[model samples]
Target: MRMKIAAAAAMALTAMPLSASADGEVNIYSYRQAYLLEPLLNAFEKETGIETNVVFAKQGLAERLEREGRNSPADVVMTVDISRVNELVERDLVAGVKTDTLTGNIPENLHHPEGKWYALTTRGRLIYVSKERVEEGEITTYEQLADDKWNDRICTRSGKHPYNIALISSMIAHHGEAETEEWLRGLKDNLARKPQGGDRDQIKAIAEGVCDVAIGNSYYYGNMLMDENQRPAAEKVNLIFPNADGRGTHVNISSISLTKSAPNRDEAIALMEFLTSPEAQRIYAEANTEYPANPGVKPTGLVAEWGEIHPDDLSLQEIANHREAAVKLVDRVDYDG
Candidate 1:
């Protein structure tokens, strides 16, 4: 049944290609939700007189692309997490891209060295502490989460989740596998409850007194504040950008890649270049409430209020290389058990 549903969805996406319209269009396979990307695409269309057609899915685009092979209609692939981007590259589904616009606007660390993929925005893995139970300057670094004092007081999603995996991968980059394994075990032992739910649920647990501290993405805090029921819980916790004193906070990105068999190569490159432009970056940043990947564009709205984010200097590619080790360490500690 699942396979049938996925096949039907893929067929629906591929049946309509960019050439269906007189105006040049770029077909996109996106993991990002429609509501978040529609506005940005609309801006792109208005600016360049190009049409944007998107097939939004939660998963399976990579497999679908590989199955479709050379005949695939997908011109661009956009997704969150370095693992997903690397997955596309490893599958040989995306091609290398290089342009003065892309290379100049984006930092080298945030894009693929071979130009196969580029990041559009970033979000940090932040600590959310109950204002009443935790004090200022009490918790300043991720290493402190392993301390015995936080035992029975910390909350998070499953350790196997990609967001956590990327964070753990960064830990492996900064500290060796053995030390990272020890830290993973210590953090697991400190859990307030069996790991469950999304990042927002962790913050909600903090407000309910089920736990005093939770780990979640920085954008989730802003998202919660925009929601009425969630705003109450969001208001109760203060965000702590861990490792601010040392390497800076552990961060992840939302990124884009060009399909290996892109039929509309020129149009796809145009959309990719537009996405990295300051105008489009500003619109995307404000609409999605994420920190723009472009250094020239400052974060606005609720994100700006969170204060300056000094992102960790580690290269995303380096962190991605350690993902396998990180996943093994999670299981070694039985982190989700």
Candidate 2:
């Protein structure tokens, strides 16, 4: 239901510099690159008549947010992954909120169960199969990637990466640790290429005929298609939503939360609701090639073309909870295979 009242809601590589200041504005340390979010930021400023200043960084925002502490001027924190969001909560860096708009806009599992954070965008870590090489129904679920039919023909990014860890954690939530480990082992045995590069590289490999199937998040394909530069890589393979028969495919989020000592508490909460509102949800989902977290807001062109999927109903916290087990399993099994 689109609430008539209102609603809710890095840098590791590009690690861009943080913006020192922007007069009469919230300082945003965003993990998304400058171009990816420029349109929305520009739109936010135009609509509200408030200049929105954002600094792009990956590894250092959490530390920086922590260091700024009581004196920090950040009105809102925007970043990726549940573990990192939980880190802000764990550090008491985020504030709990209760807004009718948010409560109605986002589902329970997508946000912080306590409202410390709210999801803005979603990306499924789904299976990607080469259209020409594989039978259409041969691979439908993530579990099928481990089948002997795929032996020595899989390609993926390293499991140590947070995206893969989150995916494995979702698997743990769905299947328990033992079954999850066995699946990782099976997934490992089928690698055609050593785990390397970003999701786009994995998709590009499929385009190059390096593997029969690849597992990656959804936005990589979206960004590729959106960016004139990456068009060739974007067209190589087709997306496959996995595990539809069981728990559904694992999904991840890019979300935001208010800083604990926000100078502009009202502004922060207002921004949260603004981001999750149907209008903003539509913009983020369409422009960024991510699924909108607000159930009422249908994804625009990019995601619509990819097809609808049922997000694994498991809580985001459960995925973060099982991160340790996932890492241990990946290491023990040499997931780099």
Candidate 3:
């Protein structure tokens, strides 16, 4: 069923090969980091002789799409979070794509329900704790962070961070606002230092004994443990996947879609199909130190080394389904307030 969908999508949008120099030119508007996305783009260009041009930004890709509109030269819209995908959809800036390859590749949870966006890779939102301070097997759940026991021993990135927002949203998905609020209030009281810096900084603070535990997406840990500045933080911290009892770990995706008015619609579809194939998926995962959306693909070595985790099966639609409510709850709780 999945494979058939991808093939149909591939054929559906492709037109005359637009006789370019086969430079494999693909114009991508991405929110994913340039360093993480570049390796994959380079590899694709090398294999297909296509030139990959990227415009990387933290926000406002939608505005760019809107500005360009029907005359937009963009061939692909690639970025993170379900909210971003939904934004593209709401703007009518994305087109539906079907490819048996994509279907067989990405899980239904990671991809758009209506075939508009396909999750290319995923990151787990989990806990990071100080090895020297946090005893092994002491904390096992996200709710534990809200426990009074760890008060003043926890460090976190800013609540305003999207990752944190999505995490709070996930809690709403499972436990509702009132219950989540109680947890939030507890966590707020427990703040080690007012949620300063990025995920890496939280782990670093733990190493510095500023906190005993922290919450972060998995890749920061992967990067910290690998390429980032090393210290006790890199050495003394461990990662834990929480919420796996029934809801599974909170997982977020970096996905791709085609512009609704893409001038190079065929090129966009081709790029999308090529992306879901095994080769691109591998690069996508390895580069980002994330899990590939395809079930058949093993996580990159770093991820495999992180050990296996049961991810939340809730679809992008389901996770995204609660966005408005999640936003309201985040504001109501005054997470950053």
Candidate 4:
């Protein structure tokens, strides 16, 4: 319980600077909330005798790392979403790390080929339909979101959101830019309202009878179901794994990278390897209701209750490559409007 957690802003102003190479200590800059990481980090510390320090932020951790450069005390950076992790690589803030343990624990497609970053857990971009309105078999694929029959019945968060962007990127990977663009436009035309709020809001919209369908991540539904206030709304919708019979559902990940300037390199790598272990993977996955990236670890609790996920085999690298195109398609279609 010797963990130190600081808000990014507070750390900048008041905290004493850390040594570049502190013994038995690993520093982290994370976009993932501290609570979600607490159990995993605490476990790492107790077992390995390495103290953990974390600076948590919703935004700007990457830029902060860039600013601090080689002198930065950060060892490992943890964050969710493909675009964010790819941004770290694009900015040249992380170093390549390859190990037998890492390779054995993580799927090839879930980690960078060059070993710059590795995914810890995954969550699918799921379709949510009103239990009362949409038929179970009526909308089974993402392609059908554009169908005329569902016009004025669909709801979603902003298309430019990373989750939607990744989904669109996957679409571009599978169908090419032109076809993806057309699908985006058709989806835009089906919106029940201007894109607004988080994924949970889309589920709420369905509950309130504002729309019959929505797009959201699997964990959001699980989270909502766990909350008494939101469970009623969550219960109104059924989770649909789109394209389960074909290309499979598109999934995004929560990932970790070793900073280029990691002073605690050995401990950092140990932390990474430990995270992929069955014990840690189970803790990480269950904490957020996400699928474990370690293939040996199966999702439990509510996530397991949802059944198996056949994730789209399209490489995440390809999804990252198509992200710019997906953003362009979103803007081109005025999807937020």
Candidate 5:
């Protein structure tokens, strides 16, 4: 019966309009790459016999979904960063979902108050310092990036980037807007070079001795170590979970949402629930060297070797709320200049 339902769903997907939702099929529009999601999707298919379809893009997915409106074929939307996911909520593009499985598997701080979205995995905003040039305890907090001892020693990507914006937003939540502005000015004054590249480039800059410390996501360091060509550079730096002993490291998430126009709501919910399962969480996190959002699932492989992370308890929504201020502060300080 399951196989018959699955086959029928697959055929319906092929024959019907994109907006048609079938009983045993789920459709996903994702900003995350296809390769990362394949394993988890495959497992979901095998277990529940639901057919899955995915459209992967780097940008414009939110716009696409907005244009499609009620006819949109997207049942689930997946992407990284709080700002992107929050955009779905702000635009009313995604509907809230409440299920015991989802709420139970994910933590309170990680999900929306009304369940508009749920995070699947998290990556820390890490500090990477040249292992040889910087000594232990030399730099231990995000606040230290502003200290005079590190003037012309720090490297980072554009402050306007969503990742940095989210981090800056967290700072505002902890400190008032006035104090965060001062901190931003200090951090900007300390830049080794005009912030010009992605997180990986900052790591590479460290390897080339262009800077002594860089701000980056934890997964990039792990991914670089896994690549033979990048391994040498990666090995040159030590990863720091800043503020670990105090407020804990700031972490960003990769998350999923149920589109307001979900054609196959049941199948979509099934897939969402499956993703939070221990089996799916393990496969999902290990694929990209990320920490599982499901706290019961432990980090493995190279991610585990880096040691445990104590994530900041600040609510992601609180961080999202301050995004505009963070961007303004970045520009006000001329951080990229």
Candidate 6:
């Protein structure tokens, strides 16, 4: 499995490097996998007669663009996680863009205030509890993760991973840094094992009796259910949209940005607007099993079956602002150790 993933990453990287492009073409450097973005790109090309060229990599596109400077051929940068998109903006690899359509389609909190990036899709940070062990209504809030009764029953991925950091950042946003730090310490004490593995592994752990509950993103439940071998393990757990009754569920986005060096700025903007359109947003949600950034669009497939998500009203930019403090709290708790 590791070899296959490595080979896939290698093949994705070997795709042609972006270069100065023709009039009707837009070049993209994406951390998002090809399968995830191709449907949207294909639809854009078919509708507008503009070509889309892509070079995919899991990391380092920001540094590469920094090195290439003004000569970089990337017109758009696409990636998952706000931290990554924020990194591009911080490095000055992305340029702020504004359009009436874009501004109208995305919520204020979901996009950068300066328009440097826009969220394409979102997913909730939810809890999954073993169906056999945890009863309905037994747990309902992020604050409960730290409750003493749950000691030795909780599981999580590394606290340093962007997903957890984002969740922790939200904690910092709602509670002050000091209170969040205390919560982290208590949450750490509840762990079934030292924080390890991806979200899916946590679900798998619940099935194996390694733990009774786990924290993970909502879409991963869809992914696990889609796999034949993973479905049983997925069925062993039930999802809880934490904090639904209070601040609403914490959510994170997969984002897109306009590059500072865009040579095909017009065409790139066209594609960007196309992605925000209801039609393309629906297609994206259907293909990825994630919530559309455009509220007018509805999710399909298993994600739709999971039910409507009430996203936390807190500003994501503010949450991003607290990320550094969140990381410090994680270290202070020795969360992964």
- Highest lDDT scorer: 4
Clash totals, every prediction:
0, 6, 14, 0, 0, 0
Q: What RMSD does model 6 have? A: 3.5
Models 1 onward score TM values of 0.94, 0.90, 0.88, 0.97, 0.94, 0.95
Per-residue lDDT tens digits for candidate 5, residues 123-229, read: 99999999999999999999999999989999999999999999999999999899999999999888999999899999999999999999999999999999999
Lowest lDDT 10-residue stretch of candidate 6: 1-10
lDDT string, candidate 1, 91-200, tens digits = 88999999999999899989999889999999999999999999999899998999999999999999988899999999999999999988988898899999999999
lDDT of 2: 0.79
What local distance difference test score does each model get? 0.87, 0.79, 0.76, 0.92, 0.90, 0.87
| Model 4 RMSD vs true structure | 1.5
Once model 2 is optimally superposed onto the true structure by TM-score, how far is the C-alpha of residue 240 displaced, in angstroms? 0.6
Error of 3 at 284 (Å): 1.8
**CA shift of 313, model 5, Å:** 1.1
Candidate 5 overall lDDT versus native:
0.90
The segments of candidate 6 whose C-alpha lies over 4 angstroms from its true place after superposition are 1-16
lDDT-best of 4 and 6? 4
In candidate 3, what are the lDDT values of residues 1-337, reduced to their tens digit?
0001111122222331222233336667777656677667666666666566556667777886787677666668888877787788878898888778778788777788778899888899989887777787788788888898997888887776777777877787888878988888888888878767888888788888898889988987887777656644677888888866767898888889987766656666777877888888898888778888888888868899989988988776776766777777767767666
Worst 10 residues of 1 by lDDT: 1-10
Displacement of the residue 335 alpha carbon in candidate 3, Å: 1.6
Please report the TM-score between candidate 4 and the true structure.
0.97
lDDT of 6 at 117: 93
Candidate 3 residue 7 Cα shift, in angstroms, is: 33
lDDT of 4 at 151: 91
Q: Any idea what lDDT model 6 has?
A: 0.87
User: Candidate 3 deviates by what RMSD?
Assistant: 7.0
lDDT measured at residue 118 in model 1 versus the true structure, 0 to 100: 94
Q: What are the per-residue Cα lDDT tens digits for candidate 2 across 90-179?
A: 778888897899989999999887888899999899888887888788888888878888888899999898899888888888889999
